[model samples]
Target: MKSSRIQSFAAGVLIANSAPHLATAVTGRQHLTPLAGRGSGPKVNAVWAALNLVGGTLLLRASRRGGTERWDGDLIAFETGCLAFASWMAGSERWLRTNTARQE
Candidate 1:
């Protein structure tokens, strides 16, 4: 159960992380990614997004094998992870924009 919850949470984080990169990639824009850091271009971001999406899916499916004994707990943990990552992303993006504006 604990392992499953952890997997679920991690899966949520990875899945959430993929969305922004995927959206950026589709727009043919560059985005910072762990794989290529600040130099990540659209193609690189696309590949990074794919990797994260697939990895998260695999983790989520695996975690589900534990059954629904604690479904609610798992769901909450997963939601927390998703929300946490999303909030962090939004905050960081805003901070970066502000700092960049100041620099220019």
Candidate 2:
């Protein structure tokens, strides 16, 4: 794929990755992210989320047609896959922490 396509795909993944952090930040809840370590703080998550959103938007805008037009299936799938993988990893890490804490 071309660089524009790759950027578009990355933008999708970044936005997907930002969702939970953004939601938690807006709702004044804590979330686990790499920056947050385990449970840093709502504000921290918010900052991280905002950064993600900015980066994603920038990438999308740099893509073909400035990401305003509709995207193709392959690109969407690639983005979705990235999102799913990242989300799963985050959730799995949280789950492991919870289980470990429970056992302790």
Per-candidate TM-score against the hidden true structure: 0.86, 0.67
User: 1-104 in candidate 1: lDDT tens per residue?
Assistant: 89888998999999999998898799987788888877688999999999999999998889989487667788887888899899988998787652122454
CA deviation > 4 Å runs, candidate 1: 98-103
lDDT of each: 0.85, 0.71
Error of 2 at 85 (Å): 4.1
Evaluated at residue 101, the lDDT of candidate 2 is 36
Residue clash pairs of candidate 1: none
lDDT by residue (tens digit), candidate 2, 35-84: 85757578988888888889888977777553445677536755774777
